[model samples]
Target: MNIVLIGYRGTGKSTVGKVLASRLGRTLVSTDAEIVRRAGQTIPEIVAKLGWDYFRDLESTVCQELAMRDGLIIDTGGGAILRSQNVDSLKKTGTLFWLTASIQSIASRIGGDTQRPSLTGTKSFLEEIQEVLTERTPKYQAAADHVVSTDGQSITQIVDTIQSCL
Candidate 1:
């Protein structure tokens, strides 16, 4: 089975995914990175040129494709769960771990990242985080096989918790 990491951008999904994949000797596949690779553009660029719908379509395709593989550490984009089909596809042969952190923790972790475009174009950074997290929390909770909190935890600690859960 694959181990899938699902969470907000700043929740350390990418970082923990790397360590988990290394520790378990599994290939690490990030859906976001895959989308960028397949589209030949960064996320912000893709979103800017094609729109969020197009970006999400690419994300869903990546999720579906990765779901067919095994023994992988699949790190998904934050909005991957917005579509039920994506969640269903990912859960087919994967155990989903939802990583969560407080808004402050998330902001501090991703304050200066420009690779991803603003999810909400109008809100302040903190407000966008709060709004997006609030909206996605239920979807994350519903799709998750296990929930891991990243607040006050190192990447190692987070990976340890995930391993213990596994």
Candidate 2:
């Protein structure tokens, strides 16, 4: 089985995934990075050029593919849980770990990142984080087998917590 990390942006999924994969001797696969590589564009570019719907379609495909693999530390895109099918697909072969952080912590972590496009273009960074997190919190909770807070936690601590869960 795989250890799948799913959560909002800036929640340390990718970073924690690396440590988890190393500790468990598993392969690391980041859906966002894979999407960028396959699309030949950055996330913002994909959203701008192909539109959010297209990007989401690609994410769905990635989610399906990731679900069929084994012994992987999968770092899912932040919005993967927005689509129920993606969550179900991933849950089939992986233990879902939802890495959570406060809106303030998420803003501090990724507020200035230029590569990611906002889901709600009308809102400010903090507003977007708060709104999106509020809307998606239930879905995340539903999809997770374990939830680990990344707020004020080191990479090792987060990894240790996840390992203990497994």
Candidate 3:
């Protein structure tokens, strides 16, 4: 079975997905990384040039493609759950694991990565994170078959929790 990992930014989706894939002997795929690669630009560059709507469309398309594959550990971007169709597709593909972390924790984890192209000039840093998390919570909850909190958890513990959930 496939394992689709979804969560807020900096929730360790990518890192945990990689670790889970290795432990489970499954291939790993990150929707955000794939979007960046296919767009032939970094995420910031894509958002700057093509716009978030454009990027999100690309993300949905990529999410669908990856969701169809089997025996893969897929890590999706935080906002991937915003669209119900995306959630429907993901649910049909495999088990969904929502990785979660506190807003402060997420901020510390991501830590000024310019490549992320998040709410840099739009709002206060803390407000931006909080806003995004608040908006996405229901969407994430709606999509999850399982939820795993990464806050105060070691990577091994996170991975172990995910395994147990599956």
Candidate 4:
């Protein structure tokens, strides 16, 4: 019952992950939270000091560890699909579900978070998010064994959709 959630940020990976985990009686693990815990810093702090490459390496390590766990729901970082190896590893380990959402949904949930390193200083923030999301389209699709759109839906509905997928 290793249900891994992969998607762009603010797509409700963490929130939906918690719901999914509860519905399925599974443990929940968030890679970003794990990275923060291990590094004793917030994601923004880690990115600022250690850099993206370094953070990605850690993300991979965390993914590897989570891959070996059982009865778990993993909420991966948005860019976790950037590395093919990470995608392969996660797919091999569990059923990967991509929580698809519009750029508007993403911006609505995360627009105010200054700690969001990805779109913090971008000139056209929504466009920037859209661009990044477009860039990852094929990769996310390739990595996911299933897909669920979260826009205009309640969390419980999203969880129900995930249950159907499983």
- Best first by TM-score, ranked: 1, 2, 3, 4
Estimated TM-score per prediction? 0.99, 0.98, 0.96, 0.94
Q: State in Å the error of residue 58, model 1.
A: 0.5
Give RMSD (Å) of candidate 3 vs. truth: 1.1
The Cα local distance difference test for each model comes to: 0.95, 0.93, 0.88, 0.88
* CA lDDT, candidate 4, residue 5: 95
lDDT of 3 at 158: 96
TM-score of 4: 0.94
Candidate 2 is scored at a TM of 0.98
Cα lDDT tens digits for candidate 3, 102-139: 98898898887777876546887789898888888988
Candidate 2 per-residue C-alpha lDDT over 82-149 given as tens digits, one digit per residue, 9 for 90 to 100? 99999999999999999999888998999778989889999988888999999999999999999999
Clash totals for all candidate models = 0, 0, 0, 0
Per-residue lDDT tens digits of candidate 1, residues 61-83? 99999999999999999999999
Top model number, TM-score? 1
Greater TM-score among 2 and 4 belongs to 2
| Model 3 misplaced stretches (Cα beyond 4 Å) | none
**Candidate 1 clashing pairs?**
none
How well is each residue in 46-102 modelled by candidate 4, as lDDT tens digits? Answer: 888988888999999999888877778999999999999888778776999999998
Q: List the lowest-lDDT window of 10 residues for candidate 4.
A: 114-123
Q: Can you give the lDDT of residue 148 in candidate 2?
A: 99
